[model samples]
Target: MPFEAEEIRIDLMCRIAEDGHWHGTLGLNVDAQALWRLGLHPDQPTSVVNGPSPPAWWHTAGERYASRHAVRRRHDGR
Candidate 1:
């Protein structure tokens, strides 16, 4: 089935861990059907692969994290 185009917004918050690693909370606001079409479930965690050269926004506080990490979905929060 063809997927419908919709506007989605995601917000993320990053923090430095005790080991100096970066971790964060990701929030996604999208339609459930749209998410399914993208092979993603609203109740499961999702992993993202960062390329060698990512956007400048991905880097913060001299820390370049998110090389490859999983983001969990927040029920009743998104």
Candidate 2:
């Protein structure tokens, strides 16, 4: 994801729900101790539930819909 804070990064463990739909988000790595002490390697899944990134078209469509609707989910997804 492109943002003003380029140094900030997060690793989102993506997964598909039971509704036969895929959902996942992979962000840039921005950590030092997590890598050194925790050994959380960048660009690597720590578990077998590794999922791929969503297609670009999916993102574009989402953006379009959200823009037209002007709706956003809260932090708790509500």
Candidate 3:
């Protein structure tokens, strides 16, 4: 099968931990820079043999939570 790639955005509810790590519910217009730093960049493909599972601290909680805030916004709606 043939696949075509395109740019996309991601969103997340993020927080910095005391240990200097991050934790939060992942939504999806997540900054490419942030994603790249976190090892979650879509442009760079990865596999389980060499990479870890998506961080447990950040994940989709459920259908309802995911549905609520997984979008990219140009302006702050916070």
Candidate 4:
């Protein structure tokens, strides 16, 4: 039998560099059960891995000078 997939929405507040100055928010659609297995909760504060920066000039500002040091979860005014 085919099973339906369950998805969850999460908000991430990422700090792309060590300076902790530049930050951005991202919305993610992830597998609900997988997130639960990994101990992730909705509206929870957590750290995530950094991906490659976008090719735009403004997007490269934070990544040009320094590497992506860390990422964190953000609360959506809940």
Candidate 5:
């Protein structure tokens, strides 16, 4: 959310899954259009799902900034 891209902004929408888990929708704002994608794949394999940004000053070589903004899923006790 702290990216310097003014032409594009990412917005997240919270939702509850059928299994009672919380999920978020990743949205891209471009030219007054809201394009959205959904998922909670936070591992390394899905790293490019939302695109990658350079690591912050405090991170190491293999570290990335996009890792901080992951879609957290929660389970509801029935």
Candidate 6:
């Protein structure tokens, strides 16, 4: 089985707790970074992203986006 790799973006709101660690959430009603991807999959239930507010910009890590992103499972790309 051959597979190709691609990247995806996701956003989440995180907070520091009294335990001295960071915590994030994707639940409803929060200030999460929020998804701005294309190919609407509203029924797909996002397990993973918001990238390139325009879907054509900042598609690589070299741009240093502050948001969290998902990459190919076996990818070693930068």
Best candidate according to TM-score: 5
Model 5 C-alpha RMSD vs. true structure (Å) is 10.3
Candidate 6 lDDT tens digits, 1-78: 011122333457788878777766654432222322432346444653443343334445535553565553422334
Model 2 poorest 10 in a row by lDDT: 31-40
C-alpha displacement of 24 in model 2, angstroms? 28
Candidate 2 residue pairs in backbone clash = none
lDDT of 2 by residue, 1-78 (tens): 322255457787777778766767667865543343333456455653233445698789888988889565433345
Pairs in steric clash, model 5: none
lDDT of the candidates, in the order given? 0.55, 0.57, 0.51, 0.52, 0.49, 0.42
- Model 2 / residue 50 / CA error / Å: 1.3
Error of 3 at 20 (Å): 46
Which candidate leads the pack in lDDT? 2
Candidate 2 TM-score, C-alpha based: 0.28
Residue clash pairs of candidate 3? 9-29, 10-28, 10-29, 10-30, 11-28, 11-29, 11-30
Candidate 2 lDDT score at position 29 = 68
Query: 1-78, model 1: which lDDT tens digit per residue?
Result: 223345466789898878786878888777765655444655545563222333465455235444355554643343
**How would the candidate models be sorted by lDDT, starting from the highest?**
2, 1, 4, 3, 5, 6
Each prediction's TM-score versus the true structure: 0.29, 0.28, 0.25, 0.22, 0.33, 0.22
lDDT of 6 at 60: 54
lDDT of 6: 0.42
- In angstroms, the error of model 3 at 54 is 10
